[model samples]
Target: MSRTIRALAIVLGLTMLVAGCGSSSGDSASSSASSDGKFTVGFIYVGPKDDFGYNQAAYEASVAMEKAVPGVKVLQAENVPETAESEATMQNMIDKGAKVIFATSYGHYEFAKNMAEKNPGVTFVHQGGLKGDTKLDNLGTYFGTVYEPVYLAGIAAGSVTKSDKLGYVYAFPIPQTLANINAFTLGAQSVKPGIKVITIATGSWCDPSVQSQSVKTLLDQDVDVITQHQDCTKTIIEATEAAGAYSIGYHADASSLAPKGWVTGSEWNWTPLYTDIVKTVKDGTFKGSKYDGDFRVGLQTGDNPFVQSKYGSMVTDDTKALIEKAKKSFEDGGSPFAGPVEDQDGKVIYAKGKQPTYAEVETMKFFVKGVVGKIG
Candidate 1:
C-alpha cells in the first residue's frame, strides 16, 4: 500500500479501537471541581522532557502556565512514544483529573483525535497536525511560523561559516520541515550571497545516535556550521563542542549546549498561547473548531510566539544588525518566501513583486537553489 493509504488505515483502526474502549472514570472527574477548586491540565510529550529541544520547550511552557494561572494543576507524561501507547498515556492523564490535554507531537495526532471523539468533555490540543480542527469539535491544532526566527538564525550561520558551505540536519521532508530548510537557506543567502546548504535527512526526530552520525557526516563534508530541525540538542552539542563547528539550534535556547561555538537560534515562546487556551477553557469560551494558533501573531503583535536567542559574543556586530533589521521587516508584514524565489530546478515558484500566502507556504514541497538534497 502507498504510504498515505497505509497511514490512513492505521489511523482508522486506532480510532475504532480507542472509541470501542470508551471513556473511563477520569472523564467524569475532569468536569467536577477538585477539593481546592483547581482545574488540572495535562501534557503528553513524544520525547524526554530534558532532551533540551522540542519537548523541553513545551515542558517549560507548561511550567509557565502553572505559575501564571492560579488554581491550575499541571500533569505531564514524558517520553510517551507516538504510537498506540500514547492513547493509554492520555487515558492515564484523564484518569488523573486532567480536563484538557496537549499532545505535543505530530505523530500523536491520531491518538489525540480518537480520545477526543471518545470523550467529548475533555479538550485536546495537538501540535503540527492539520486535521484537528476538522476531525473533531473538541480538537484544535497549533504551530508557530518558526520560519521567521529560522531565517534570522540563517544570517548568523551564513556569517559564521568559514567555508560558505553550511549543513542542516533535518528529520523529515514534509512541508513544515521543508519550509524551515528553505527559510534558513533564504535567510543565509540574503546575508551572504551564493551560500550553499548541504542537507541530510535522518528520517527520525529524536534519535540521538542518528543525529550524532549526521553531524559527523556533515562535519566531514567540510561544513563549518550546522543547524538542525530535530527533537534534541544533540546536533548542536555534538557539532559545536565535539566537532568544533559553529551551530544553530531549534525549539529552545541551546546556547549553553555549545557555549563557544553557539550562534543565535530560534525558540518557541508558547507561554502566551498556552495561557490563552487555558483561560478559554476556564471561561467556557473555547472554540476548538476555530482555534488555529499561529506564530505570525507572536511575531507581529508581541505575543512572543517566536523568539531569536541572543547572538553569541562570537557573532560580529554587523551580522547582528542585519538580523535585527530582517526581524523588524517580518514584524512589518514582510515574508521570507517573497517573489523572485526559485526552486532547485531553477523554476520560479513565486514571481517577483509577490508574496506567498500562509496556505501556499504551508504546502511548500520544493527546495530553493543552493540547497543540495532530495526530499522523498
Candidate 2:
C-alpha cells in the first residue's frame, strides 16, 4: 500500500498485517545469519522501499551495509507507521533476532526510546531525533547537514531562474525544514541579489496529490524554478516536465525525473554512514548513552554525507563556478547563517559579525528575509 493510505489506515483504527509477521523465531538453524553467528541488524522504514525519496535512500544504504560487512544479515520492515505499531515492529524484529535497530523517521523517536528501554539488549538509532530527558542509554540520533548541499543547489537555481522567483514545496514547518529554506534563500541571494523564494507547506510528507497541487500553485504565481524538502520526487518531476519550470530535488538523484529543467540537487550518500555504524556494532564499540552516537556530517568531511548531484547539461559555467567557490568556503568552516541575517519581519537576528550556534540552528523557528511564506 502507499504510505499515505497506510498512515490513514493506521489512524482509522485498522489493524494492518505486515508481511513476514510470523515467520521464524529468528534463531532458527536455517535462518540467514552470518558465519560468525552475530545478531541481525534491523531497519524500520516510514515509507515504501521504492518511494525514490527518504525511504529509498535509507534502503539503499542498508543494502550497501550488507555488502560491506561479510556474513552480515540485515532485516527491514517497510511502511511502518510512527504510532504504537513502531514499538510493535521493533519487538517483532527483536523476536526475529535483531540486535541493532535503526528507525529512519522523526516521528519514531518516542516509540524507539520505548523499545530501547524495554529491550535494553538492542541498540537503537533514530534519524533526526534526540534522546532528550528520557536519557535512554541505548538510543542516539544522527542526521546530515543537508542545508550545506541545498545551498549549493540554490546557487544553481539562482543562476538559471529567469523570473528571480523560486518556489519550495515542503512537508512541514519544523526547524529542520526552516533551516533548509533559509539556507536556500541565502545561497540564492548571495549570487543573484534580492531573489525571492515562495514556499508552500503540504503538511504531509509523501502525498503526491498535495505535492502536485502545491507545485501548481507556485507555477501559477510565476515561479520559474521549483525545489523541495519533501519525501518524494513528484514536485521535481511535475514542475519541470509538466509545468515547464526549472527544478531541484532532494534525498536522491532526480535528474532523470526532470530531464528538461534539471539543474542540480542535494543527495544523501548514506553508504559511508551506514557502513561505519555497522562496523562499530560489529567491533563491540557501539554505545547507547543519551548522546553517545549523536553524529552529523556534511561535504567537508571525507565521508560524503551531503553531495550535489552532477550538474545537468543546461547548468551554466558561471553557476558551476559559484557553487564550487561556495563549497570551498563551507569546507573552510563558513556557514550560510553568518552575520547580517534578518528575519522575515526585517529584524536583525544576527549582527554584522555574528552567527548562530549549531544548537540554535538545529532549532531555528523564524524564516530569513527574502522568503515569502508563513510557517503554518
Best by TM-score: 2
> CA lDDT, every prediction?
0.81, 0.80
Cα displacement (angstroms), candidate 2, residue 275, comes to: 0.6
* Candidate 2 accuracy as TM-score: 0.86
Local accuracy of candidate 2 as per-residue lDDT tens digits, 1-376:
6999988978654432433443322222134534457658888887777888788888899989889887678888777777897787788777767778889988998898888888888888888775655666667777788788898888888888889999998888999999999999999999887899999988887788888888888888889989988877765566556778888888888778888878888887888887787777767677752234566665555565767887888888888888999988878777778889999999999888787766677899999999999985
Clashing pairs in 2: 137-288
**Error of model 2, residue 222, in angstroms:** 2.5
**lDDT (Cα, tens digit) per residue for candidate 1, span 1-376:** 6999999999999998886455321232234434566798888877667767777889899999999998898877776777887888888777777789998888998898899899898988887777612646677877778788899899899988889999998888988889999999999999788999999998887678888888888888889888888876665565556778887878777777788888888887889888888888877766532453332353555565768887887899899889889888877878888779999999999999888876677889999999999986
**In model 1, which runs have C-alpha deviations exceeding 4 angstroms?**
1-33, 132-136, 206-213, 288-298
RMSD of 2: 6.1
Q: In angstroms, how far off is 370's CA in candidate 1?
A: 0.5
